[model samples]
Target: MSLSPFRSALAASTLLAGFCAAPAFAQHERMSVIANGEKVGFVDVARTGNHVAVQYDVKNNGRGPTMVEAIELGADGLPVSWTLDGKATFGGDVHERFLRTATKAEWSDSMGARTATVRGTGLYIGQAASPWALGLYARALLKAPASTLTALPGGQVHLDKLGPATIGNVSYQAYAISGIDLSPDLILLDDKNALFAVLDTGGAVVREGHDADVPALADLATKLTAKRYAALQKRFAHTVDAPVRIRNVRVFDPVSGKRGEPVSVVFANGRISGIQPLDAVASPSEALIDGQGGTLMAGLHDMHAHISLESAILYIAAGVTEVRDMGNDNAFLPDLMRRIASGEVAGPRIMPDGFLEGRSPYSARLGIVADSEAKALEAVRWYAARGYWQIKIYNSMNPAWVPAIAKEAHALGLTVTGHIPAFTNADAMIGAGYDEVTHINQLMLGWVLDPKEDTRTPLRLTAMKRTATLDLASPRVQATIDRMVAGGIAHDPTAVTLELLMLSRNGVASPSVAEYIDHLPIGLQRRRRQAIAPIASSADAAGYDGAMAKVKQTLKLLHDRGIRLLPGTDDQTGLSVHRELEIYAEAGIPIPDVLRMATLGPEQYMGRDQELGSIARGKIADFILLPGDPTKDLSELHRISMVVKDGTIYFPSEIYPAFGVKPFVAAPKMTLPAPTPKLAGSGPAHDAMDEFVY
Candidate 1:
């Protein structure tokens, strides 16, 4: 999924760290935040006598955090007291405080309060820290023995010195800090160890007057990230040369909603060649995989995803072999797809949806942004020429232009799907030729909101409270459902995203992530336990709860009325897709049907079921090996032992650790064919089989 406007703002906050200094008087510095080549925000820092004060404000696409921070540094250059007060990415109140003493430390933020006894020293990773905090952590780690320090709460922080880099006439040293997040945060420092710039693939926060180098810095960041993932691909991706035989496995047939008898599935050249009886003999030259009586089913599909280098591998690890990229950076996505196709990266097969947003203050910076009706049509043609599967209209789009845009897209044989633009309703979009609606809130908000209430802001989320009291049986609600059914409009509810927003609470894991939150990295674990939607009172909390129930109720209502429901999670982690399936089943859809929606349903919807989706003769081999039948229990989807996509086999256990995730299950035995003997004249046997053993 694309970064929520809120998260985009939050990530922007971490793009720059302050320069370390102990001025006798006072010093000041300023930095600019650039995202996708656009100046979106700024960071200002004032330091006086070991005390630092910062004001960070960012406005990109009309929404960003405006934070004020105060910090007192100890003699060791670590934060002794820090206070942050501001509005979060979605306008949620942010009041975080952290204090460290020689004996102990205490802090309280949105995730609630905690205290830890200090031994010698521990770095407190602030939940809502400003960019300056990065410098604080970096300076402390550089001074520490081995350039490593224990982080409060949990985990450790390690720093590695990357090679030097130069921007313009100035030379700088680069460093990478790991363990604080899934991907290492890369920063540049001058000879004095003063932070100069913080680089990110999406953007960069560079020292003032150096903004011209943002693109170069971002390119460096992307190359660094690509290099890391490339290494991982080399280490984890296993390519099979000979025909592969997966023996002793029962296949779950989504078409019949039943498990077939144990069979030996054979595939060659990335296509399933046969489904033989368990007693069938295998060729000695074939690679043999003992399934150990597991259930093999079609690999799951995440219908809504925004592919990133990190999420790409995570998707494969979670048994998601196919993903429909709802939206993405126009240039970056195709290159990523190319890498995955060339085996330079490990990722799912991508079906990209061209993202089209109207030019507005709140417009998201992805895909194509059009300012006029002519530009909108041009964007449609652009996507058509590029062969986008569909055109996804975003919140800032003009409702008046959707009809023409949709018409143009239809003429070019591209389907239209997306958020209900501000001031417009789902009914209007469907009439305008939207084949599908993107989010549950986008569809339901039209019923609960005034025409003047803009959905381009967080109101699209907080307004869900109004849905708690909405009558599903009312005429207006039924009319929209009827319109959807009549128009064959599909819904990509992304219910898990809404659940994460509305139902989340401080110190409480949202039900959507409760099952596997513990398996996530420490940073993500903390985030999952925090609230995204600001709850002001008991009434507000209850309203959100009731709203979630109504969301499920509305889903069931749509299902009953025969409106096709597409299972999707606007979440990148492949785990959320499984939760999305659970939510669908909980919404009264049958377990078997939910599995179908995740497997064959999306493939059929995308018109690729002929060569993909299920495990059958002549079809591409994209399936997962699991310990239990997902048709009976959707939760079993998480326990994937093996995933085979286009004949490339991946054992989750072998890769999960690379991301700091504990293995869910051990990989079953896979015996490879013996390498061929080389002739005396030949230097050596050079077949791919001689490269490695699985």
Candidate 2:
């Protein structure tokens, strides 16, 4: 469910918001947009007097934004007038404009138009600006008092100097610009304060001819980000060395589909030691957590995810203790997993799935890109040897190579899953030994599309419109269902993702995210309200509405047919996992079953049920404390009070504020053991005292 297309557009809109960085004296400049060490696009800027024009394009994995920006800079180095016209990543039209006059400031974007009286020098951040805008922001902030400025529309921007670094005998000053989103943008500027590069772990937009510096800059970005997360981990992750006792909580047993009577769950050394009676005697040495009659359930699992350092903490905050990474940067994921395991960072338990794609101009740059049959089989072995739970075949994979690849993966005891390759259907892949299909659209497209229709592009998404008129009871649809049922194949619907793509409208919050939208950051709030799919007319909008209805119907049909449903949000945020389960319940699946799919079902699917998934003596200590029972109302998941992953406790109330989210609930009362006092005869009183820290 990565929805890389829409995410790329959002990333381009936000990540490159300040990319316009040419000096007024400069005539022209060019830069390369590098993603995962590969050049994906470029930003070209031409200046004539006070007016500048920017042409920005990024093409990766068959989708990206192409933006044209025109700007008029004021004497203060902020834009007085700016216009952006472009095609968004998923081919949606983008027309954003901002103008500031002597009396007022006005702007219009996907979020609609607004005006405000002129107060001071405010910089307008475009929803679809080029990479040059970041440079524009950096340069202006450098001259402002304390390197801070009032940003237009809302919010403030603050810049911090990150000192200087020398790469290849060239020195550049690095600075982090914050107050824009959940994370800061780390950019390097030349001696003149001109934008040198915008760095991120995923990619970098480097000044032209400085591509060689991308790798180093990206590594630096990762280290800087990791340092911030590490500080948060130290601040939040509470590791009680002694046994922890959570009292007055009812345990939701997935097997029985009901909550037991209030009891005290005790755990130590990252394993549940006992489930005791509520009236059991208390141990003075144990840490006490008062659940206050809340429900204690096994930590939820997001069956589909692409984990990042930021999303890792979000997952914990949302009660997702485990995540199945659908695909990710091969070089980055292993280290991230290691850090999570060693308590160096905060994140969910990651079950890695190796990504395999065929070499092409549109290939995803995350994992292995095989250009031949041998390379494909080699990828299967590479994943097997490295302990990946499965191999995910992507859009560009050759259908002809799947059989051999699946065979190799099966022989190595790894499950086969992924998008239905371009020019092929789900039925063909299932016949070729696919244990599961990645997305619901990937599965349904086989029934609605012709064999020659290519799904390697955004067609896989836009073509879902055809399903609006598709008959569920048709023989063609049944045949695919029959195969899936007979083979016990699973489906990762990522239903929330479809809701985002098909049902989102400009300036209106999508139904799936409406419940929690107001609690998010302004940037994310705006992103969620805008449309990802292009809807030019009422008819087009109706088609998408009907398509979403059909998608739900298809989900109901699949679940009714006894097909395995793996709840996943191909989205990065932990909040989307809650929405994913809600969609399942909304589609008529029982709430208890949806909860099971999110918790125990995934553990069972991955053959780790014996050690994980539910509350029991000797099982791993991974569960969340909620104020209400999710088995009755799935939305209760949003009210998670505390999450314990492998015995380390985290309070959602404490984690949300770091990302600008309003806490859903206050943390439960936690009481640690009293510190021991030193005796008069003890040598060195400080060394003899017991200090308890969270």
* Top model number, lDDT: 2
Instruction: Write candidate 1's Cα lDDT for 188-257 as tens digits.
Output: 9777666778877767878888899987887887787788899998998777788989999999888988
lDDT of each: 0.82, 0.84
How do the residues 599-654 of candidate 2 rate in per-residue lDDT, one tens digit apiece?
A: 89999999999988899999999999998888888889999999999999999999
Candidate 1, lDDT over the whole model:
0.82
Alpha-carbon TM-score of each model against the true structure = 0.94, 0.95
The local distance difference test score of model 2 is 0.84
Error of 1 at 37 (Å): 2.4
Q: Model 1 — TM-score against the truth? A: 0.94
* Candidate 2 weakest ten by summed lDDT: 12-21
